[model samples]
Target: MTIEPRQLPAAQRTLPAMLQRQAAEFGQRPLLRVAGRSWSHADAAAAAAIRAGALAQCGVTRGDRVALMSGNRIEFVEAFLGAGWLGAVAVPVNTASMGPQLEYFLANSEARLLVIEADLLQRLHTADLARTALQTIWVIGEATGSWQPPEGIRLVPWPAGAEAIAPAAVQPGDPLAILYTSGTTGPAKGVVCPHAQYFWWGVNSAEVLGVGADDVLCTTLPLFHINALNTFSQAALTGAEVVFESRFSASGFWPSMRASGATVVYLLGAMVPILLAQPEGPGEREHRVRTGLGPGVPAAAGQAFFARTGVRLLEGYGSTETNFAIATAPDSPRGGVMGWLRPGFQARVADADDAELPAGEAGELLLRADEPYAFASGYFNMPEKTVEAWRNLWFHTGDRVLREADGAFRFVDRIKDAIRRRGENISSFEVEQVLLSHPAVAACAVYPVGSELAEDEVMAALVARDGSVIEPAELMRFCESRLPYFAVPRYVDLLDDLPRTENGKVQKYKLRERGVSAATWDRGPGAPRAKG
Candidate 1:
């Protein structure tokens, strides 16, 4: 059954309250299954209490930041809920974050403690711990290899609960998590998400998919992002079960869903095309998955996926900083456009001056929620950015979209330099920072190029130092260690100089128009090469 947000009490909108209420209502109903461990509805609150006690033993208190760096696992959920239960903010670091990125997130959020997987401890070798506020490190599993903690920092095995602690008096408007989103022209910004925002996320997403009790939702996405984290809220609110696969495997996706007995699946736009690329088999139609949320999916690819797998993929528009503000239902009139504006949300296609554009015109998509705390409070520790984004009392989406006369919103393109590749947001500024660090590169401009998969591919145009030669293979190896695998550039162009405006700023639009040329180096096959 759909969760009606209006009917929920103010207290019930917080994580601690939701866990307690669900425990009483659902009892032994399965709430989560991940990494071979299961948590029943009753176990949710119990585990959270135990974890909260453990956090308190480590000197964590209300409003303190606790960062979690791990993949899909029971311990990730434990740390996240524990922080929420204690009225502390949980900072989920992307598991793919390298040392530089990791240090930035920890420093920016002022996380007092970090719970990281044992395998990822080596990443700290590159991070400057002294720069951050972190004092304690709880390592899950055996810490292997020669890596050791720096002085003034405590490193120990994951601690056990000292005693069951009562939930902190957390309000719905309190910050629950600080999720970092890539910035266009600067470093990543931490989005301060209130507890009530997630409550509405669950309510609206469940309503869109018609989620009900007894249904099983499975997601192969990582636990760090809103897409996967929101699954927990969906289950708790509806008394449904959720399964978390450690990672996405095209060959193993169907088999895993069948193994988990998933009725509802979550997928990104790129995942649908990848799944359809695999060899057809009975496994596609053998699962019980009826529907899925596939945002950013091309209409053709979504239709093909549904035809082949018998699972209708719904398109929607949402970001880390917003709730599920727009979505398509099964009965939506059109297939290509992002569904109409969701309840409790106001949307507008406005120009640079914030004036609303007429229907059939393209402009920035601006949004504001009527419900209190339904949108992220603002970018954490970024007052100017918050003011810029929330100016005119509407959150500027930085996405160019067209509102059709029929009220459907069609995506145009991103107005920002942020690139979306394989469901991950890659910051051009961040990538350029890394590229500029290399001694061989005198100057560089990173931008997105269209991919056949209907997503963006990372590409870089570079001007080598006078005495240096830029080798594509060598540059790729350097990027692999510094940037996430997905953020590394796939194509590189050796340019004499980047096109520039009269003011000498890099004209990236010209670079984008130039696209792939004969002089460009392709790291992989099937990339279209331009004629000489």
Candidate 2:
């Protein structure tokens, strides 16, 4: 059953309003369960109301942006909803960011206050704490925290339970959260997501998963990402329970699932290989999960996972800028294909001129909502970038995909993630897909390093499976046998582990900057070229 985007009830269109309604309808139902404690709908709603009042006490006013950086927990959820209850925008910072990047996010967001986890206090460098716009700092875990504030900035403890007050009136178009995603070529930019956008995400996910009131959604990804935040939204919509872990642990994942009694889980594509690589356990198949929702799971891995456990892994293609535009049903074949486009949205595969490309041809993905205010509002404080992306009256996804005539789409790679070798554009995604399909490879990131000539060279960082050491030469021979000579990775680096963000996305820019390292193996005619 295709769930088309339809009008949500007026009360459910905004976060604060929706929480109030759900609290009234299901007061005793646990909406959030963490560390053996539960916060029912009424409890959460009341807590958010009090937190909003606390933010107001900190001089936060309507439309003010409150920067929140924390791990996956109930406080993160409360702060986000509380800020929205006050008609303010919550800027969720990536906990992995440090120093200048952290400063850049604070300055760029113009956040009036910062709410951070006590454990993450060290990541905010001295220079970042000295920023002028940051009026106050709210520490979540401790009453008297370790970090001291500079003059003119007040450091306060996180607010506890207070009397519930009237929430600020806000419309669906108001900003809910400003989410930051690193650019392929530049610093991170904040994507301004509106209240209505999240509402639709919840509605659509409820329909796609057939979430029932008794079902519980479990997420290991941090709340900073859309996949996790929107999972929260869908749980609220379906009146379902949620179990959000502080982090993803491949070793303890099955145990956590069994303990939480989770009926659904969310993950990224990279997690698929990592989870599959974990040594098979006697208890692996003994869990309650019915389905998983995410992107990037290989078709073979998806099938293998089902054979191991009765859960079906559903694939979807989306970004911070829009609701999930393309997704698969539980039984859809995977192999990097993102499945069919849902109703209430129009999509196209197009060239630079915006002309629609033929089926099976790869090009930029353009998306627009069939309903108003269903996508992101724009990029915060970056009008030129926003205008450029939203130019031609379509939101340019900056991703290349092949769209079949039946409206099914197969993701190729990000436009900036492509490697040009001797004038032929090679998809880094395709290269990784090949490497991952190999039995010895556990996880890998394929990227481009600059060539001495006009184009780029293919480089790969692979994590070999335990007990099966892969020699660079053997992997090169395998790649050469499967891929075009030019398309094969000329430089290979087998690493103990790849650098990853908190959400598990490989930071390719770090690998590119490292360039050809001492450990890099060269299969080409000369020494590994380091030319930019």
Q: Give TM per candidate.
A: 0.97, 0.79
Error of 2 at 261 (Å): 0.4
**Candidate that scores best on lDDT:** 1
Clashes of 2: 1
Tens digits of per-residue lDDT, candidate 1, 1-532, equal: 6345458977789999899989988999999999999999999999999999999999999999999999899999999999999999999998888889999999999999999999888878889989999999999988876787778889989986668899999999999999999999999999999999988888889888888888999999999999999999999999999999999999999999999999999998888888888999999999899899999889999888888988988889889888888888898987998889988899999999999999999999999999899999999999999999999999999999999988999999899988888889999999999999999999999999988788998889999999999999999888877787788889899999989999999999999999988888988733221110
Question: Against the true structure, what is every candidate's RMSD?
Answer: 3.4, 11.3
Q: Return the top candidate by TM-score.
A: 1
Model 1 stretches astray by more than 4 angstroms: 1-6, 525-532
Candidate 2 wrong stretches, greater than 4 Å = 1-7, 143-147, 331-336, 417-532
Clashes of each: 1, 1
